[model samples]
Target: MSRMRYFTKVEFYNYRADSGGEKAGYYALIFFFYNALIIYLFGLLMYKTDFLERARLYYSNEHLFKLAIYSPIFILELAPLLFLLRSKKENLQSIGLTTSNTAISILLGIVGAIPFTYQIILDFILHKKEIQLEGANLWVEFLILFIFTALPEELMFRGYIQTRITGLIKNKYLAIVVVGLLFALMHIPFQMSMVNMTFMDYLITNWVYMIQLMVMHIYFVYLYTRNNNILVPIISHTLIDYIQLYIK
Candidate 1:
């Protein structure tokens, strides 16, 4: 093959369409571990460097810092995968993204967000405390949340991780559960930051919330799997985050 064709070949990534389920299962393990290591290393680096503390001290720069922290997912996961797909002349739909039913997808997102929003409202009413909004403009914050946070995350978890695992396992429901757990585990750093307790104490106290987040992950995964469209999960995920930002 020519040099250009070399990289564009779908087989270049080692994902064979005819591979046995056992092979796919092995690939899933490798993919999960690679992503987990990268994400954990990024989190550890931030902690060691006290980036979160700096963001708190220089509250005006918090948004910038947040972007800096989240950049790793793009650099390590999303970008590479996207490049490989593009090289293959593959659209996102090759990995289960579709827009044939855009209206229904959007409506599903809105409907799914209702209960989550209600829970947030209930928590605010009970606690009489809200998340602190760090930015000057709600619109700007919304864009940041959707672009930097929601887009990358959905692409990583639902688009790449869950899709790959499901394809590998040949069991959509089981893949959702597995990916959901991973999603919740990935929130550990954020959870620790939000709570003032010691690490162990925080984990203990937040166990219930973590379970809730895991279930929510399943909901988002289901949205994606149901329609084979990532946009729904992205919209639903972003809506939930936007509500959190608004309340803060």
Candidate 2:
């Protein structure tokens, strides 16, 4: 077997350190980089090698490269979280409580889908983007797209990674910032330089998406803690994505 090394807090160094004496961060690095490599290779296989065109969080077209990019990551997400849950049971114990608070929290989550819904709506109303409705292939395409685009992301971002990291960090707000940034980082390879004219443009663009993600993560984690199950965040994420799809 091969051993792995990690970088702490997502930074590079001239000297070697043990990533805070733990390799979890390295696993995250590997997971992320592996996905990037897969996206490129799969794009080649599909002859969609024009990866430079996408400068946003998602691709405009559906290809096998994308399908491969997400599903495996989503699958691996569950394993790390489950491992964390067992080994760090004490740490995770306080996260989500199965209490009566679940009801209110869940309601709040459904309400919190407004921002993206609003943006997508405005984009359509202003004709910034063409709105597709009732096309013979629309529903089918959407369902397939939604499953790959939304489900895997919500699963990775909200379902597993965020939850485990919060346990490790033991701070909700900090964890949100960290994981939210990661959620943004995960999108960067897809767009690279086009998403940002410079690093600042990219950071700012990602920051908007990151803020929305952070808020959603906080809200879902709130519900999870109140309700005491992973399902609340999962369902909340799914609902939000559904609204994003339908609103435009």
Give the per-residue lDDT digits (tens) of candidate 2, residues 1-248: 01212112222111112323133434444544565555444444334445434422365544544554556645553455445445533233222323445666557555554543666766767876654444435554455445665555655555445544533454556766777667666655445433324545766666777576566656655555544444455545655565565545
Top lDDT prediction, candidate number: 1
Q: What TM-score would you give candidate 2 relative to the actual structure?
A: 0.52
Which residue pairs come into collision in candidate 1? 131-248
Of the candidates shown, which would achieve the greatest TM-score relative to the real structure?
A: 1
Candidate 1 stretches with Cα past 4 Å from truth are 1-25, 50-69, 83-90, 119-135, 189-205
lDDT per residue for candidate 1 within 116-223, as digits (tens), equals 788887878898866566545676677777777777778777666664564455555666788788787777764454443455787787899889978988787667
Report the error of model 1 at residue 30, Å. 2.6
Which residue segments of model 2 deviate by more than 4 Å? 1-131, 134-142, 166-168, 193-201, 204-206
lDDT of 1 at 144: 77
lDDT for model 1, on a 0 to 1 scale? 0.65
RMSD of each: 6.4, 9.7
Candidate 1 least-lDDT 10 residues: 1-10
Candidate 1: residue 202 Cα off by (Å): 5.8
